[model samples]
Target chain A: MSEPIPLLMTLAYVAVALWLGVRARGSHRMDSLEQWGVAGRSMGPVVMYLLMGAGSISAYTFMGAPGWAWSKGVPVFYVVIYLSYLALIAWYCGPRVWAFGARLGHVTQAQAVADRFESPLLGALTSLVMSIGAMAYAVLQTIGAAYILEVMSGGLLPFTLNIWLVLGTIAIYLFISGQRAIGVTNAFQGGLMLIVAWTIGLWAAHRLTGDWWFGGVFERLRDTHIDFLTLPGGLGDMSFAFWTSSIIVSMFSFQQPVWLQWMSADSAQSIRRSASWLPTYYFVILPMVVVGFIGIFSLPDLERADTVALQLAFQQMPPILVGLLGAGTLAAAMSSSEPYIHGTALTWTRDVIRPLFKLSERRTGQLARYLIFPIMLLIVGPVAMLNPGNLIMILLVGLGFAAQMLPAFIGLFVWPRATRTGVLCGLSAGFIVTALFTVVWPNPLGVHAGAWGLIVNLPLFVAVSRVTRPASDATLARFMAIVAPRRPTSRSAGEREPTSSTIT
Target chain B: MNHRLIRPATRRGKALLALFLLVILAGLWPAVLLANHAVLILGLPALAAWSCLIILASTGVMLLANRLLPLPTSITQADPTKAASGPGERVDE
Candidate 1:
């Protein structure tokens, strides 16, 4: 009887999520690509804040962070560090991206980059790279969702069925409502995840150590496993170089494809406001980390460290709490997964297929909506079924690829001298180096493979830009005016104003 | 709440930028190594406490930056089709 309760609660959560997704299509016509792709850029600060926050904190934080804490110890703090900086990155970059999207009718990150350099091929390349990254992320989250249900239900739900149930719910709602469904559902899931994280974290600590304050847990660990509380961690693998490099690579990789869409889905002020408050949401990780530390003494030498939190839930928590944990973990997985699935389809259609086929706006939007089904069922579904690699490692590998786009972003936002040829060459070089290091050697010399990519990418970009012709001066002026508009001086006031275009 | 954009050239903008860099540095490498100990601070590990503090500091810095450097009117108020077009005709989408 108790076995059925956890599965029922998880199913109930799924039912409510599906209802919310179906109901999210309220009032909007959902006729245009802009309306469907970005919720017509109408999300307010509260919803956008939750959407961005939930989207960033995925199954990685729910399961992976605790797993690392349990296995490696203080090294897992890199998650906290990188996430804090991500909000800062968003605060500074979100307004500019939103302004570009709103004023120039840009819908995707690749579109903005391609426009900056006047290169359709460049945009296609970017779209492909970003699609791969998004697919990897989606696969990770699907595996996470399936794992949560399987663990929570005592294997009754099974991994294979859970994947279908999880992805099917997301694909249906996404097909029906697009970005609006993501925003509404993420807001609800984000709140649920925070509550569940703190509840389970504190409960585990109190039940194990008889102290709700977490001091007792630390004191015991210090007495028994002192290395767990220090650098190099329990496994002795998280060296200074590894920790620092991981943080840097993760921080730079925060400009994710889906996040760019999220930034574009609101007013500049609303985006900035949401970014300013988003870091506080990262406090959700604190208790989850504590839960990992609690696992050290209670269930040592586990075969799979990622399941530490769930294992504790099953051992110490009552059936109802276990069900809530399942729901929250599922929420984390689904909320993050939806955006990537939607983003992959949107970018693939708009940047790749549309340009290749010269499709009309109406036709392109229709194609993007239709592409969601195959992406989930055919691509993401099969990869997730394999349950490929460790959760954190998969995240890092995808981020490594995403980080290569840094040079393109520099051309868009900061440096006016960045040429199309230079960006393309630099991005290509970065990708090769990253792929080689990530797969061939895997973090040589204690630094992250992604950082190794950037080390080579940036200088090559500068050298190539110096040799190659820059964007036409007129193009530079138009682009700069929007991103870095000059002050209205009496002399400059006579200059031509920035150009704009209608959303196609 | 202020609608005016504060260019990154300003003193406040420079200060905020510096603060951002400092906060990031505080959480990595040589700076983090200082707090990498088994000692407890307010019940949490010293390293954990330091990392958490850095995150809090980052939040404070971003909030300060937001107040000091609001977005420009061109960004905040311009219509997509009618806003200033700089020097060139619009590039084809």
Candidate 2:
């Protein structure tokens, strides 16, 4: 890897992000919780599009996805399959959350959940679970940025220095500008990820095989090593059940950023309109997966799966483009990490420490910044440094744990019978089972632990709720505004009928 | 129609629900077995071709489903004329 060009390019990229971070600061003083965490509800459709898209197609998409394609073969497309419908889920869930945010002044997912369920305990529980999930996710993104630094530098910058530089940049912007910086950077990064994925994928495919070109990379796989073309994949490490459940599980994890972005936008229609273009944005990842497929034959027994995309870029692509690619990959990592770091910070200060000590919102926002660093650096970053298997492993661990949020979220607006006690019990039980499966001992049968946890989680939530009395009709009706169409408006009384969404 | 079809909106939902389960089945399991064949489509292994097509089709289905969805009153509640014009106009609070 020609270190200097990539290093300079990446430095320039970081500088631009820093400038944007500074520029993102509003004219109004950053005193309140909304200004800092949500960027004052000023983001438009374009910003929302990039924010939501980059929230997903992160280091995981740029690096982990292609790596999975190299290692896992066709099952790697599970990433594509699962994500195709992601925006729809957001479209359905987000508007209601936005309405609640608008009417009730909710900012975080935990706050919304707590408010809807009428239980601070549930909010606290959500905060704890999501905080762990978000911080752990940030660590992986940190590691991703560090790995890119080392790769681009050809190991001139050691892992320790690389991580600090990467995390330090993120931490600074997150500290000063908060969500505005993240939104602006995400728009930039989202565009870069698409461009780089295509450039490298096409170049690698052409340079490596030259047989069928970029279009036929998989065909070449079929001709030579046929296993990579099919599902249940090369080694049969996953079954259909596993792939199905895994896709479903990922659809639900740590969606707080998407929710927050939805609420932050000017209107719910903006959220949906922004989301409509996401599928096209996500299609950029396919080329990167093709890059990895190009690698399987080209690199020929590469030492590590994750390095395939970078390794190809270094070997074949022009020096300046390679440098820009490094920047783009880092963009992919840092764009998502900013939100997770801020989210973890908010949850820790708002849900955990505040409830215990009863701190005010303005004070909690200040303290949260101080709190984000240690939580990220110490607890989460250490686990990532342990090199917990691979990039996808770390991402899944966070996502699987976070996917536990799904049942409670769906129950919030959709299930009138759902109770606070039941949701709390379900989340706790599911999380424990998921942890055991993910960390200690996976089930012998080969289904994903998150899936197994859902098996326990859904039934238990239903059973517990059935036994427990429902929340007040007031709570049920308020939350039900999402899935059910809007209540019919009374022209005279100025009240909405329970059944219809139309204004009369 | 059964209780599942209490409304035309719910009917579309049922159709989408069926499609959802089908997509899941198609995403995994017996659907992917087509890759075992030697055929090729557009330079992909037949199974690869099948899977890629499935992904594209799924996206189409989702977009179509979204189009078919009952427009929430919230969109109009934000601004009546703006909802019809589609997303560019600035609405006053």
Candidate 3:
């Protein structure tokens, strides 16, 4: 009774996730590439909403979020600030993805852009860059899962085995069941994580104040020179820079492979339905901040910030609850990792294989499967060996690079005159600025480099687009129809339902 | 097509659903006080009897809500064909 019951319960949660994945695999329809990658584009609003929401709230939600709360105090709440804005983006960006996916037959973000640009080379390049970056990010997640396992088991199992088992199981099951597995699992995982996250939050709040009032936590937070609840905590150089940069940069930049989940929705209304609720789902996280505050007081001398969640659960909560926390963490990792691997395979097949070889539908599907194993091996080994240092720097760099895709997607939607050359130039400029920001300055001019780069990137897109000759009227119309408010019928000059053979 | 849910379906249905779920979930923990001869389970100062009841009840309510809620129509997915051809055009299978 003295020790927490986290271990046994976590094992049970793990077993349930694995069993669910196995059951989903039995019902899998892997004959078509669409089923394999995009979940058959039949997902309804509730499922789509949960998958995307769970997908977004990954190891980052479980560990990184609480950790950020532990270290930065209240300021980390800035991350959740975008929930509403992100929902807005989903409302707008999601339906367009569906429209375009239906018409252009897109399976990945790379395809959406390449099809719009009418250049496989552009598609290939975008896919290559995104795949490389996303693979690294996936590895980060695998490492995160392993780290939690090591702490939860008290070193009974090595971190490396945990990484291999967790990641390998996810990849294998995903390869078997594809997006259907991901959707169902994400819904379950999202619900579980929500329960666990709030439970910990409420429990911690109750402990500190002997009630659920915020006064004690707020007072304790205010006592910290860095009250995390406020901005510009007297860190003149870093605070303002981190806050403004993360908000703007993350808003514009983050283009993970899972954005394609919008395309998998059963209908246009599903997009809006999912969008409406998904952002509000973030309300579960306020308790996480309370947990972080408790960590500040409860485990005053912890070495690593990420370990805060584990330490608190083990040190304070009952065992069954700890297991519940483990289940939540595992859900975050799996929901995110399954989509990443699925997207990696899609990117590899469409961006790399198709452009160079011009493969047929059947062959393209085969090669995609071939690509998955190597990508798995690529992440599992190197990520396990690397220790987490300067995580904030890594997160910032990833965000900056991801932001570059925004200009291209936005341009396709709004500016009919945006030309291929202009897009190329805009992408180059954004990438160069983001790379420099990520590498050289890390923090420059008291602001996030990605935000600064995006400021620079936006004008270049507009300037180049206006100056360059627009694509032919027909090409422009084709692109516009996808983003148009009304759905295009076959009577439209150029409209098509997606199939296995679409080049994108 | 009424084109909206009961009462014109303000754009906030999804958000409100999530909010409602949270309140019910949070209330479950405190409901431990409602149980008789409160016995501790999992080392928490709560009743095991109440905890299991709350879990089953919450899960049941969610499932019922899901079944009862009306499904929104998806326009882009209804694929019937008018035969025509263009580059990158969608075709019905």
Candidate 4:
């Protein structure tokens, strides 16, 4: 691949992203905090779709997903099960959440939970945990981006520049544009990556190795402990039961941020519209798996599974195509990292700093943007220093933690009987349990610690909610008013129900 | 025979479509792994030609189905009739 062309392609992607960011700048004139955080509570379906998709189809879609598929085979597609679960949850839970945000003026997930459950402490704690997880996740993305750049450079760029460049550019954009820029850039990145993703998949499949049975590759894998197709490869791999539950739990945990994105939609109907199409964005994963399978066949002796895409693209494909693939990979990384960074910062400002310090809306927003600098440092700095061998494992670990939030969040929404004290107990129990299991063992009885945590957490949630006093009816009614789709005004008056398609 | 030839549009229909796609991809894997033959569509060795056609056609059907389905109302109703000027009115507002 021509060095100049790939560099130029990278520049082109940045330029298009910047142009979209600039175009979106005029939309940031909200006086309220909610407006600032949630895009003035007016992101329509199209923007919502784009923003949500961008938030999701991040570096994982490009590199991590395929990288896993390349290494593990079909299990990677298990990630899509999360999307199916999310869509179902959104269909049922989304309208209420969006309504709650709109009516009560919820700008952040912390606020959404806090107001619903009427607990400031829960909000703060939730925000803190999200921030920690997101920061770790974001830094991994930075590391991945840096790896892609380093790979593109064939080692001349020192790999670290990718993290710096991505962080620097995003910092500038995030500072200038806020969530608006993030939303716009996300939309652009989502679309660009989707196109380039299919292109790379098709090109790689047809061009390299030309559909020959990978006998040599099979022989290589067969020689190893893994069957290369089945799990429990020799004897020590995770059981099918454990794998399914882990996927289910991990995917379910990712629902919150994805759901939070739905709240930004201009209309609820937009969420639905996006849902109908957004799963297609997920179609990128299958192609990634194909890419991974190809990598396994092509580079049988590769030491690092994640680097397969970069290695294949550079060595085999044309320079121009390598550059495009490079951008797609970057898109994947940024899509995941930028949202995590921005969301972490936003959560900290809203759920932690503002309530603690009683800062004004503008000040809080400003603080949120400034918070990104340190977060970018934390996220990128550690990985660069540590150089973790398996970025995918780190990502899955984060997913396990992220999944623990589910029990707490579901309690806030459905179990009106759920109390602040009980929730705190459940969360504490879940967190401790997950941490303990993850730290101590490979996974007790072949199940992920996250599965164990949920197993412990849900029963606790039920017991606690049952034994405790319900949140006040006033609070429940207010929450229900915002979240429930049909207001009496809309229902009895025979009005056209508000469209739920809003997505960003 | 009609039931066999024509797929049901029940929840089963959507699942079937998804399953069909998965089968096609899965079937192609062996060729991908072993045959060393380029994937052909109308005797053309372009995977994109096959995949793109799938994307375009499927996306169209998805859009059409979604439009026809009875969906819940949006969270916000922007009725020009109400003429209520809110801060959210401007895309740049």
Across A41-68, the per-residue lDDT of candidate 3 in tens digits comes to: 7789888878877887878777776777
Report per-candidate TM-score of chain A alone. Answer: 0.94, 0.92, 0.91, 0.87
Specify the poorest-scoring 10-residue window by lDDT in model 4 chain A: A495-504
Let me know the TM-score candidate 2 reaches against the reference structure.
0.88
* Whole-structure CA lDDT of model 1: 0.79
Model 1, residue A217: distance off in Å is: 0.6
Who is ahead in TM-score, 2 or 4? 2
Q: Estimated TM-score per prediction? A: 0.93, 0.88, 0.80, 0.78
Model 2 RMSD in angstroms: 5.8
- Give the per-residue lDDT of model 4 (tens digit) for A1-504: 336777677657766776776666685663334544556546666776667666766677767666776666545544554554354445445555665565555657777667666777777887877665676677777777777777766666676666677788887776666667777788878777778877887777666545433333333444452444444322225356665576557555743356457666666676666655664566666556667767876777888777777778877888888888888878777777777777777888877888778877578877877787887676556565477776545555556667777755665454445667677777678777777777667478878888887888777877787777766666665543333333322222323333212111
Leading candidate by lDDT:
1
Candidate ordering by lDDT (highest first): 1, 2, 3, 4
Q: What is the TM-score of chain A in candidate 3?
A: 0.91
Ranking of candidates on DockQ, top first: 1, 2, 4, 3
Residue-level lDDT tens digits of model 2 in A1-504: 445898888878888888888678757555555777777766787888888888787787777777887887767777776776676566556666666665556667887677667776777778776765676677788888888888888888888788878777877777777778788888888878778877777777777667434556766777777767665677678676777677778776746666667767767666766765665577777778887787787787888888888887877788887887799899998887878887777766666677677777688777876776787678656766776666555455666778877767766656666778888778878888887888778743778888878888888888898899766665555454444544322333222223432111
Span of 10 residues, lowest total lDDT, candidate 3 chain A: A495-504
Quality of candidate 2 docking, DockQ = 0.16
Q: What share of the true interface contacts does candidate 2 keep?
A: 0.15
- How accurate locally is residue A13 in candidate 2, as Cα lDDT from 0 to 100? 87
